[model samples]
Target: MRIGYWWRLAATALLGLASMSQASETAEAGNLVYTSGSQGSALHLGTRLDINVQGLQAQVRVAQRFQNTSSEWVNAAYVYPLAEDSAVSGLKMLVGERVIVGEIKEKAEARKTFEAAKASGKKATLVEQQRPNLFRQEVANIAPGEIIEVHLVYSQQVIYDAGEFRLRLPTTLTPRYIPGVSRAELLGSASVHTGASGWSLPTDQVEDAHLITPAQHHNTPGRLLNPMSLNLALNAGMPLAKVNSATHKLAIEKPAGAAQGVRSIQFAAGEVSMDRDIELSWLPEPQAAPVAAQFVSQWQGERYAQLMLMPPRELAEHQVLPRELILIVDTSGSMAGNSIEQARASSLLALNQLTERDRFNVIFFSSSTHTVFEQAVAATPANLASARQAIERMRADGGTEMHSALSRAFDHDSSGEHLQQIVFVTDGSVGNESALLTLIHRCLGDARLFTVAIGSAPNRFFMRRAAEFGRGSFTEIATADQVQERMAGLLSKLQKPVVANVQIDWPQPVEAFPRTVPDLYWGEPILVTAKLPPWPSRSDARVVITGESAGKPWQRELVLSAGEAPLADVGVPVLAQRFGREKIAFLEDEAYRAGNSEQARDTVLPVALQYQLMSRFTSLVAVDKTPSRPAQVTAKDGAIANAMPAGSGMQAVGYPQTANGLLWHLLMGALALVGLLVLNSRGVVYVRTEFTAAAGRS
Candidate 1:
């Protein structure tokens, strides 16, 4: 081919490539995919959160309202996140005046039932757990202008540490990075993958990435955007000095007269955009701070109790251990904006916390891992300066290759003299969480792994479990401003001794979980749930918990008879459901460690069904027998995109777009132009003879 011909072809291809770049950039904000004829579906979205905090347990009711205003019959789906340890207990589907209660069944069975109901034109809703924190709710057979509301209720333990009790309410999730090879179809042109509900297909590492990785879209006129409100009624059972939220402004008021209690709390604004996780923390009066607590409930005439034991901060006070701290920060594409800034600030703050006796290193990971130093080094001023510079120079881009990053940190040939603690700072956006958790379970020897979750909405499930498996703590830094304060708290705990090798003794025969206890730090406590024999036969039940704090054995004994310290007596099934949830977590962890999730699915099924809770092995499904749609009309699927986490600068979820209209159309157009250019370069199409010049290529 003539040089001029090649030059002309090169220029055409470059223009096409630029257009593709812009389209792909738009995809980051989200590519909401709706079935044909449903693009104009008017979606009205709102979520109501009703939370009640009693003692150490919180029960949350989530009511998601999705109204379809389009002329066509439609089915809708929404993907969202919950607290990692939430014990989901109830699901109800409401339409107009009737209600259909959800029942827990094996995941496959639930799917079959939902499909059958959908095929028969009946109204149905299926809720399944995609991950510990991620969930998917699908509703079928909605008539035109019909309103559907799926209400979910779950129970989670309130975290108490260092004089504050904390609870997390997750509204959205960060766009996770799915690591591994994309399916051949996914790698094809955008046309081949268009209209898929999720941005990602099933990858080799994450077989169900599509389920968890929902697409995001802005609150455009034709798209569904979720905006939610949160209302909490807190009866702490005691006096609280203050109550506040780090993510949302609070509006607190005493419920009607008799007014001395901290009563009901709400958001200052009526409704806020659902983009970030809310961290609600409350400070109790010093004298009201609990040292031990126990809540009991009755289910099927059996007693279930939740236990909490704080092993005294004084023990961790006098003990300090020489350490080997390895800072692993993620510089992935999802962390490109405020997320990266927080990670950077956190890394620097941690470096400042190292003592003379501690040895430290820094590692950054995106598509690949980059170590600041080959191995752990003394925390001298010079070495610290070098680490800080490397961190400051880091930029966020590429995929989140977490597996390689973690493996590199826990290399077999690392130091064994000092106590090694791995501090992983990231947005926690990876999809292959079980694989990473399994790796940590096997590789984490004596070293502790502390995960600092960055960004507005991180993967709480992975962050919590990774820390649990590595015998450490999980800290969340949502913004750049939070980095200094949160990192300081985490680092201070890192320098102190953790209460390890914990064992609990119960007064009577009972079924309880977590089978094993992880370490406790600072004022952190030990929480356990148990199913006891029918009550009234035992002596005043005294629960004893023992552990080692600072190389010294420590013990705490609490009377479960219910006097002053811990509130007792309950009517709800939250504790019982929590026991089942914990049991399932234990079994799943064991299965993950053994590398056989499918083989162990059976072990978690019974627990899930028994407690009426949702799990990986089981799901909650509600079906209304009456058909809601006409037989002649087909139910078109509606695309309800997940809201991207706040501060994720990608322009789709509530941001202005540089590119507009159909993405696949633009892609195909660009591809066609490139094809024409290629044909012209080969002389298939007529081109001027003088157009080919070697100098033109340059």
Candidate 2:
């Protein structure tokens, strides 16, 4: 009897399981679609950035405004991008004429505080780090037809590359790919948050996938929801020869001098759609770049110094040792347009740099990985021709399986005869950065991995970190026009190391930002920031640096003058912030390698708290305290969607949130239950037939 009852129960369960498909589909589809149709309207967002330049540093103030056009209270969340190494220092919430300053707190505690404020009818704001370059901001209890403004400030050192000073700002983001074993928990939490977009869902691999993946407007013919205006004050501290925007149209207001002085620049148009990255480049007068510059400051009885030392560039010599070059390309759907084109061009250029003695292979990956050969082959004419044909015929489709592709790149064990160079060509559109870096570090045995960023707005944080772990270099090719120049430059650096075995010695004990430095490339500088004790005398303190160039020992010494004029009042804080950030990064790396979350937290918390900075495990929060809204009316919250990156594919790629191993087992059990029912029915009919036949015979 129990068995029969179980069979009946099983049949009922199977029907329920079959019916769940629709619900799962609906939930996974996001908030844009319902049984009725598309959503009514979207939350509007606007941004303004004001920048001030002082020598090598830039201080920026960003104002983000949110407006609710609907007839109900709405809570909004926004995720945006910033420079990879930015030092976020301040945040304020502006409501009416009052301002609420944000304070740094532990990440979990900040979330709980925000949630509590949200529950009680109070206006609150919270900012948390999603990635090194990505952040999420939450604003609660915005009444109907309300306008809320959020202001933030951060400091970052400008980029100096190839005799030019450059500053880049990312205005849009390409959706990232997450690869890991799926969990059943993601599907059940889809509806737990309001104001979510229709494009993504939370997943096990990327817990905040829904937060990072914003709604994209494809071919919409209206004013973009997120339009940004940038104003920059350029103070290069030297005579400027030229200034121009590499990626956008800009209106330059030059100063009243000849090729010198500060310049004011703004968008040529009033504001621009957030579709591409903004890059501004300026060149100093010929042969006028500083080879070494130092800034010193004193605060709270401690002396701080930040300096840059550009090693003299070495002439390129003939290649003596052969190399093995492994090229890994991302052919996922996200690379369907201009990104693929750039990657193809980059691959072709890399092929041209290979010599007859070198060996090479190509690995292309999306949902699955494909290789041109089982192992690397010599750079022969026939092999090159075959590779070109295969690469050109490839098309973009399917999800991004980045981990598998990376594994394929590292599959071949080196015999220690030749140097192995893995050139990864991608947009760096993957969210699981920690996992990827961990994997790379584990498999990166004496192999240098250079990342070729292939799109306008690649993930800067991921690309830079990957290069750091692989002990290589990173370069970006934003457009096809710049491919030749950039790739040629990269090839020039591959002949030999500019400097190696770099070591710095201080006259006394001092704390420096990086305990160790990477090998230097041609024309690259060694920049270090340190905190030191008060020197005995101006002439007595000195620093000695040692390195090797072209198998010859090289050394330089710099004397520290404690009585020298201070650089700026702000320099001390800037130096301290940079040092703190590096320390946190080191601790996080150690934690990742050992898989010890507790250790990471314990080590990083004190430093973060002392510096009052935002980090992966720490956040910035602000509360109004006064209950602006009644407790009875809870605010409705949702995530605001970001604009679709220009030239990126419209097709989406990721694993199904509802599909997992446990679910598949239950489905199989249901199928077995149905089979048993059919068998029992057949048995009953056969018995009845036999009994009837016997009765007739009697």
Q: Write the per-residue lDDT of candidate 2 for residues 1-698, one digit (tens) a residue.
A: 12443344354345435443321222221111111122222245578989987677788899988776656666776677888878786889988887998888999999999889888888899998888788888888887667889998887777776677878878777777644332324533433223232234344566665556554443245655377888899888887888887688899887687346489999998687777778888988886787777766666677777767777676536534688889898887777788898888888888888888888899998777999988998999999888888789888766677888998888976647677989998888877887788888888888888888878778988887788788888788777777897788777666566777899999888988667777777756777878778776644677888898777887777776553433555433766676677777777777666644347888888888877778888899999988887767755545565665677664422112222112332344366477666877878322211100000000
lDDT of 1 by residue, 378-402 (tens): 9999999999999889987776889
The parts of candidate 2 lying over 4 Å away from their true place are: 1-42, 184-199, 219-222, 257-261, 316-320, 561-572, 595-598, 652-698
Model 2 lDDT at residue 258: 32
Candidate 1 residue 158 Cα shift, in angstroms, is: 1.2
Scored against the true structure, residue 246 in model 2 reaches a CA lDDT of 64
TM-scores for all candidates: the values are 0.86, 0.85
Residue pairs with colliding backbones in model 1 are 4-692, 4-693
